[model samples]
Target: MKTSTPVGTQADQLQVTEDGKPLDAVRGTRAGDLDLRRTVLWWKGFEEQVVSRQQELHGIGEDVVLAAQAADTALQESPPRLAGEVFSAVAEGFSTVPGEVPRLLVPWFAELARSIGREVSTRSLADAAGAGVTAVQRAGAPPAGTPSLLDALVPAAEALVGAEAAGVPAVAALHAAYRAAADGTRRTVEDGTVDPGALLVAWFFERGTVV
Candidate 1:
């Protein structure tokens, strides 16, 4: 992956290109990188917003961080069970409540989707789920389908948000999660058994269940 600093953009801003052409595999790679950068910028700006609206952001921030911590802990302590539970929850939940969505989380998830691929939308539960999974994949998840990917991604995400919640630098935390997820995925795949949970989860998500 060759990189170049584009003219007229921020001096440090890189336009990640494939050779001389724009990267487009797995959803317009260059554009996705740019968009992800934009999301990072937005999060940076959100710090200022948080200062201005402490009451609103505090709870949300805590919750996000805590979720990451929980997921991380679960993955480390019980990778198999965690894989099963997460898979079952998403799969079963989607089947019953295909349109289920987190309260007031549309914008946040939308940003996540955009950071991975330029055109994914959060309006549909299936799309939203795909975007979340894809973002995890792009962050360094294995090439496997949903179950294995989630096994890697869930914990890394927990660390990502947990670091931010602890006031760690946002970009650093994100990059860390990416590396961690990729490494974990590689190890899990080497174990040679797809946790049943991961399989079920992948099955449901691919089945087009909502939520």
Candidate 2:
């Protein structure tokens, strides 16, 4: 249940990178580049509010519902048995996804909603990063959710660093990147867009893979 060292603890590095190279959190597949230091800080500051924060993603919150509904509809469209498995996974809090992968559920579902031709709402974009930042940070360490979360986070934080380097305020870059990754308003990672669901399965959840 212990969490790994947050990303920012390195000595005087301007940005965090993978294999000594910069990567994008929203887009990068190999490494998570989101600033772990900020993520940890944000999580600690908001833990009291988000750890117990429970709202049906997109089901009960603002326009996020449209995104949530789209993901649900997409799941329903899958083969009945596979759909059932996905639903079961959801019910089990993404137990099979490994690490702090579950913390990304809200964002992943929101992004999945976007992938299925639904529009990612502004509310969903903001809420996902806001609440999700705290949620991921609150998870446990390696073999639990923390390591995975931290791994996933590397790219996300790196993306924000890029945003800031481009003159975006440090305070606003995270939300902006999260929104861009979700809505396709802009590219946060190198590949073009972010797919939280696929990322979970292909990168985080699946074993012997990128992680």
* Top candidate, metric lDDT: 1
| Model 1 ranges off by over 4 Å | 1-37, 40-147, 190-211
Error at 23, model 2, angstroms: 17
Candidate 2 TM-score, true structure as reference: 0.27
Candidate 1 local lDDT, 1-211, one digit each (tens): 2233233331111111222333221222222122323433333232222233223222243433333334334434543221123322222222332121211222324434334343212222223334565554554444544435466445555555555456543334444454445444333432233332232222222111111
Question: Global lDDT of each model?
Answer: 0.33, 0.31
Candidate 2 lDDT by residue in tens digits, 86-133: 333232333323323353454443332332122222332333343444
- What is the alpha-carbon lDDT of model 1 when measured against the actual structure? 0.33
* TM-score for all models, in order of appearance: 0.28, 0.27
For model 1, the run of ten residues with the poorest summed lDDT: 202-211
Q: Cα lDDT of model 2 overall?
A: 0.31
lDDT of 1 at 101: 20
Candidate of highest TM-score: 1
